[model samples]
Target: MTAAEPNRGLIHFSPRSGWMNDPNGLLHYRGTYHFYFQHAPGSLVWDTMHWGHATSPDLVRWTEQPIALDPAIHPGDLWSGGGVVDLRNTSGLKSGDHDPIVVFSGTQGVRMFYSLDGGFTFTPYDGGRVIAQPSGRESRDPKVVWHEPTGQWAMVVWSDADGNGVDFFVSPDLLQWERTSRYAAGWFFECPDFTPMDLDGETVWVLRDARGSYVVGAFDGRTFTTAWTSPQTITTNPGAAGSDYYAAQSFDNVDRTVTMAWQGGNHGATWTGNASFPVEQELVGTPDGPRVLSRPVDEIRTLRHDTQSWPEATFSAGTHVLGEGCTAELEIAGASRACTLRIRGCFDVPVAPDETLRLLVDRGQLAVFSGLDYRCLNVDLDRRAAGDEIALVTDGPLRVSSLVLHQLRP
Candidate 1:
């Protein structure tokens, strides 16, 4: 299939004109996936933020839509938040029988916007009135989810009284809300999401941390109690260990629950760009606990140009070259001392004599070094070996396979 095929590999959606960040207002309504984000049409800065909208039937192919929420519509700028479909049409009835309600956060307060003629055009409800705002605290990044058990709506807002964290509120009707509790201090928790996941026939709440990492816990609508001692780090591209990945969130559509992140330069950096790709997230069991593993979605099979496989090969302290768009595998043995096998280079860095053999890959350079404590080889030269193996993508060109020199200990 061609690159522009409908079912192409991991696809990405950014503003057609400018800077985009933080996937916001993710909703699946009327058999379509709709999402919005913080977009600045002119510059790369975050000052002038607007809601950029896009829709997709399948998660792989996205169709861009017009600006959903403009800053000019409201007095102040648009901020990060989420959207939900009002299946019941609780707001009011329109000519089409029902409308989609979008709850978003802005500079002044949390406001609701609705679309009568489908999700194409949206206007503020109740004369664009502000619903809720803290007295002394500034609240933004509102993530709303409907609680099925209590039959109530819950929202988590990014606020600061002691420090930057999330505050919880409950609403019987979407309009009026009551403050219930607060999730104590942490780093700037921008996009907080609470969803129920099935694990071993038990339900667990997944909380997404925008700035740092995501947490899996048990939540009872009013309060969230963390079940895990530590939070899991969410990265954009699990295939490569680059520093340009950050700020990912989950999109729970009808078909699947996938996650996406902003793939670009780091914050306060000048070299930021766009995403390499978007992958599907799956929950798998590990020895430690349940972890998230990202892989190119099944649609990616259409993007395969050609497939090449290397059966069995052994190399020792030598340099080899290969053409582009190729996959190669190597198995080494009989090295008494830890040694390095450099690909596309001639230098063989010494691996510690006692450590296990290591595999490293730079941009296009690939190598294998020995030793567990090979600090230089593991840290500086081979940056891919820093994280857990299951979380890493092994099918791509950046995959590194390692082998120990000695025989099995059994």
Candidate 2:
């Protein structure tokens, strides 16, 4: 079968046949990356949930695989959740040797399945044990991870106890789980992911909020007591610029972490249909704080075509065409404070207000409009102060840097 098209400068990996949400089971096994996601096999609308599978040799180019687990196998229906590879076989299901185990959550309870002959097919362990079912009906979407120090398993599940928060649980042998505590109960904390990262110098817990914000905290295994001092928001969407991106999940790939999310929502134009891209998350030190910036992984460096760099350019309002599928960066100089840089393309025009700016894989025409209502779409800046500024820089294969322009305001 032919592989799916590459995700431009962004690594795209959503279901080619249906709706996708809440990336789950992001694990690296044996030398390949395997991840599961909540999927419905016919539309962009969320209906029934099944585990959509995909594998990547490099974290960027992905090959869509068969459905990992189907909810129809059980009676209740499969919900959104995560998966992990049991390296040591802590469940004690083997006869002569240990095997890799896959643990996930369903509507009934948390379930366990293992692949003895390799990860080709999986069978439930102990007839799919129900690890924990507190209150019995309101718990779903489990995020499980194995704690190295404790040598036990830790899980975070979605609950409605305090208005849609994540409940904590610990299991010694992947069977009996005890409810430990509760974390931030926001409006709707759908997919809760906790990973330890070395930030600056201290180890911090990165928590992704489905509603909007991405929070980092100091976690101590038992509880995430410390609130995130530096709160950052994720604002990029893959399928369409205006579509809603939600339920993002991440996994460690040894050298870097890769993330995926649901592409569209209950409402939107639904242009590209339903799909998503895998983004390599990087911790960049911004003027504001330690922010997470995502881009298509460096493996895509193999796909570069005709790179260009313009050292500098004066700001005169006119249409500037940089070839299709290009990467551009602009550094601003001689600015009183901040200026507005607008990117016009096939997607909605994205305006960035500042000194340093970056745009990736943008196609369509570029134009500078005037007036608050955008009355003049083809106007040029007049007599803009000129200085010895590195206005525009483009390296071959379409990488541009240091382009400066002012935002059109009311």
> For all candidates, what are the clash counts?
2, 25
lDDT of 1 by residue, 1-410 (tens): 12222211123444555667767777776667676777776776665888777787755467778888887885344777777776765544455654565656665477777777556677876777777674336777777877767887788777776876677888876778787887765544566766667667776766766642566677777887776655666542222222344455556434455555554442212212233244455455678687655544455344344333322333433333322211122233333444444332323444333333433222222223232111111112122222211111111122223332211100
Lowest lDDT sum, 10 consecutive residues, model 1, at: 387-396
- Over 1-410, each residue of candidate 2 has an lDDT whose tens digit, in order, gives 21222221123444566666667777777677776777777665677777777887766566778877776563335677777766666766654453564647665466665566445456766666676764434777787776666778888887777466777788877767888878754544566776666677666667766633567665556676655544456653222322446666777435466666654432222312233345566555666566666654455555444454444434333334433322332323332233334332323233333233333321111212211111101111111212112122222122223443322110
**Total backbone clashes of model 2?**
25
Stretches of candidate 1 exceeding 4 Å from the true structure: 1-11, 93-101, 134-136, 227-230, 236-243, 266-276, 285-287, 311-410
The per-prediction CA RMSD against the true structure, in angstroms, equals 9.4, 9.0
RMSD score of candidate 1 (Å)? 9.4
